[model samples]
Target: MYREVPSARVRGAVLWWSTSPSWTTPVRILPDGCMDLIWSQRHGLLVAGPDTTAQVGTASPGERYVGLRFPPGTGPAVFGLPAYELRDRRVPLTALWSEGRTRELDERAAYADRPERLLESVAAARLGEAGGPDPVARPLVARLDAGGEVARAAADLGLGPRQLHRRSLALFGYGPKTLARILRMQRALSLLRTGVPAADAAARTGYADQPHLSREIRALTGLPPRTLLTTTP
Candidate 1:
């Protein structure tokens, strides 16, 4: 079972937890322009970076995982590094923080009944020290997710194309163009989950057509639309 709740301690973040049953299945984690700080019963503490493609993950039966997912541009502030450095990777928390800090966090998580809350608290404290996420991050994501053209969005944000690209790399681990594509795919997937036909979902979400949608989905997820839906949360 899996569940997520909006984080009260950290703005624009979610706290989630999941437990594997006696039987295990591969989980498809799609790219959604976010990074996660995770605590696992089996793996200890880890960081999940933004992905350019879907990630296939599995767990030992009966294992539990708790995570705090930070929105695009929010993670760098809390993690104290550029988002691009961790893109498409999952690394031990010790890799990003000093052993002393990592060990303290591990102890806290081990003693907390709800480790996701601990993850959120840690993120909140770090983000406060960093003076919070970039002010442009939320607006940038909103503009791209709404299907605004990258150039126009940059201009609207009072940024030159190069400036936007550079900032995007640091904030989202990719350029605005790729982020837009991933956000559009997420929109299409949401529509599909609600029983929207593939063709209609494509058109509504700005794809050229059904085939265009199919191709994009397969490229990003390595699966057909139907298969992808079966694995989606």
Candidate 2:
């Protein structure tokens, strides 16, 4: 479904594309210090922010795209975690890269120069074959998806509230509650896009009401739900 090419410039840049049969939603590509260009079947093309989180889904036919991956060292600072963990955090990728605030990592991956190289490298890596979600993050993801309360999810995971906060801050750059809210908002967006009424979507996605959902949507995308739906691409 997705193909990656290695960088030609410095062997650090990689390019990739997803061309599968299934309707792909906007993928929430987590920022791991890598820059990417995503093309969707529905959405034409998108250049990601350094640390910004996006919802990627399958587009219509003929919707294809390319991405450029930066080398480990040269890449932006990415708070390492699944997409669900970065809720409500507005830290920029450039800020992280400039301050050297993240964990010591090789952000400059060989996908930096000449993204076509990513196809080869990604083919070799076989991301599809790399089975299973991250063990540590999976439970959290599941809990959020199931609409479990953050406090309950933490308890179920055998983590104390304070401990969960610490771990979340270290791994996700945000607290667990914030991440949960983000996941809920993403789900709400999907529902809205699919013709669900805003009031219903808000209740299903855990917001206090439509107004609450509106506020969050405005904060994240700088637009209200109606505006976003009208001009998502």
Candidate 3:
């Protein structure tokens, strides 16, 4: 089971929890341009970084996990590392924060009656200390989500292309072009999930054609669009 709630303290964050069922199948985690700070019953505290492609996750049966999902460009403030450094990786919280701090968090997480609340408090505090995420994060994402071109987005953000690319690497773990493609794929998937035809979804989401959509989906998710719709939960 999985569920999420909007964070009351942190902007654009989602507090989520998941439980593994009796079966021991690997779960495919889709790339959603977000990072997560997780506390697991079987593991300890972990940071799940932005993913360029789908990642397979496994848990012991009945395992439970609590997580704070940070929207794109927001993780650096809370985690104190560039997004690119953590991309496609999952590391112990100690790897980023001081051992003492991580230990304290672990202890509190272990004992807290509402661990999700603990995650929210910790993230809110750290983010405040770091002065919050980059200012460009939201507008950039919004521009791209609206099908804006990279050059136009950079111009609108008052940044040169190279400047935008550098900031994007730090904030989103990739260049603006790559981020646009990912965002487009996400849009296509959303339409597909609503039962839109593949061709229509592709056309609406900026793919050249349905075959192009198929190829992009296969590359990012390692599955055909049809398989993804049926397999993803």
Candidate 4:
């Protein structure tokens, strides 16, 4: 079972998902250009970084997990480290923060029924120390989702290509082109979840055709578009 809850406390957190899969197989996590603050019953707290390709993972049978999925550009700010540094990796909170802090958080998470809320507090504290979120995050994602090309995106935002790439790597764990693709994938997934035909979803979401959409989806998910539609959420 997997379900998501709205985040009332953290800005740019798309949602918090709780999962307890049957553990008959490893789950293939898709590329969504997002980072998650994850808590595992067996592994404690960790950061799941932005992924460029599908990642396979599994839980021990009967174990549960709670994760706060933060949209692109939020992770760097929340963790006080460049997002690129953690790309395609999952690291324990202790590796990023002091042992004392991770221990405290692990204890709280072990007790709370909705432990993901405790992570919101952790994000809040980090944001406070950093002053606030980067001003470019929302607009950057908006432009890319609107189908702007990377070079054009930088020019429109009055940023040079190198500067834009640097900031994107720091905040999103990749360059603008990859960010744009991932955001588009997210849009395609949303449309598929709503029962839209793949060809129509592709056309509406900026792909050239159904095959184009299928290839991209397969590359990021290791599964074809139809396979993904069955578990759209």
Candidate 1 per-residue C-alpha lDDT over 1-233 given as tens digits, one digit per residue, 9 for 90 to 100: 99998999998898898988888778788999999999988878999989999999887899988999998889999899989999999999999999998999898898888787788778888988999999889999999889899999999999999999999999999989999999999999999999999999999999999999999999999999998887677
lDDT of 1: 0.91
Better of 1 and 4 by lDDT: 1
Model 4 per-residue lDDT tens digits across residues 7-70: 7778768555655556654677888888888888889999999999888876577777888888
What TM-score number comes out for model 4? 0.94
Summed backbone clashes in each candidate are 0, 43, 0, 0
lDDT against the true structure, each candidate:
0.91, 0.53, 0.92, 0.85
Task: Quote the positional error of residue 168 for candidate 1 in Å.
Answer: 0.4
Off by more than 4 A, model 1: none
**Candidate 1, pairs of clashing residues:** none
Q: Estimate, for each residue in 1-233, the C-alpha lDDT of model 3 and write its tens digit.
A: 99999999899999999999998978999888889999998777999999999999777899999999998889988898899999999999999989998899899899989999999998999888988899999999999988999999999999998999999999988888888888899999999999999999999988999999999999999999999999886
Task: Compute the lDDT of residue 22 as modeled in candidate 2.
Answer: 50
Any idea what lDDT model 4 has? 0.85
RMSD of 3: 1.0
Per-model TM-score versus the true fold: 0.97, 0.52, 0.97, 0.94
Give Cα distance to truth, residue 131, candidate 3, Å: 1.2
